[model samples]
Target: MKNNLYNFTDKSGSFISFSAHRIKSLYLPLCNEILMSSITADLHGDIKSGQNSFLMEPASRADLSLSKSSRNFWVYVNKDQVWSAAGVSKNI
Candidate 1:
C-alpha cells in the first residue's frame, strides 16, 4: 500500500504546508492505526514485521506527487542526506 503525502489545501482554497513534525506526530500515527487495523483481518498474516515495517521514501514517490513546477524548484539532497534517510538499503 503506497501512501502519498501531499500539501493539504485549506477550506478557504489556500494550500497548507504540513510540517515534518506534523507528519511524524499526527499523520504517521493515523497511518499506523490503519495499518494495525488491517493486520487484524489479514488471513494470510502477510505482515512479517510490525508497524516499523512501513517504509518512508522521503525523496522518491512522495516528491513526484508535487506539481511539475514545484518539482523544478526542488533542491537536490547530497550523499549524506540520502544516507541518513535510506541507509544501506539505498544501494538495493
Candidate 2:
C-alpha cells in the first residue's frame, strides 16, 4: 500500500508537505523535544528524496509524536495552539 501523506502549515501561511516511508531507527536533534528521521514527500507534486523530513519542535513536547502509521495527517501550529488531524485527505 502507498504511504499516507502529511501536511504541515505554519503561522506564516507557508506549507511543508511530505510522507514518511520508513521511520529512522536513530533520531537526530531537531530541537529540545523533536528529532529528525529519514522520510520522503512531494513538493509541488514532485517526489522528494528520503532525506527531506524534519519534525519541528512544538511548544509543548507532549503535543506531538510520529510513527509508521502516521499517514494522511495534517498539522497546524501557531504560538497558541498545536492542532493535528489524522486519516484525513484535505489541506489547510
lDDT of each: 0.29, 0.33
Candidate 2 off by > 4 Å: 1-68, 87-92
- Writing each residue's lDDT as its tens digit, candidate 2 over 4-61 gives 5445467774544353524323222233233333222211111112235423322121
Residue 10 error, candidate 2, Å: 34
lDDT of 1 by residue, 8-83 (tens): 4677755444343333222211234334311111111122134455333222323322313220122236655432
Query: In model 1, what are the clashing residue pairs, if there are any?
Result: none
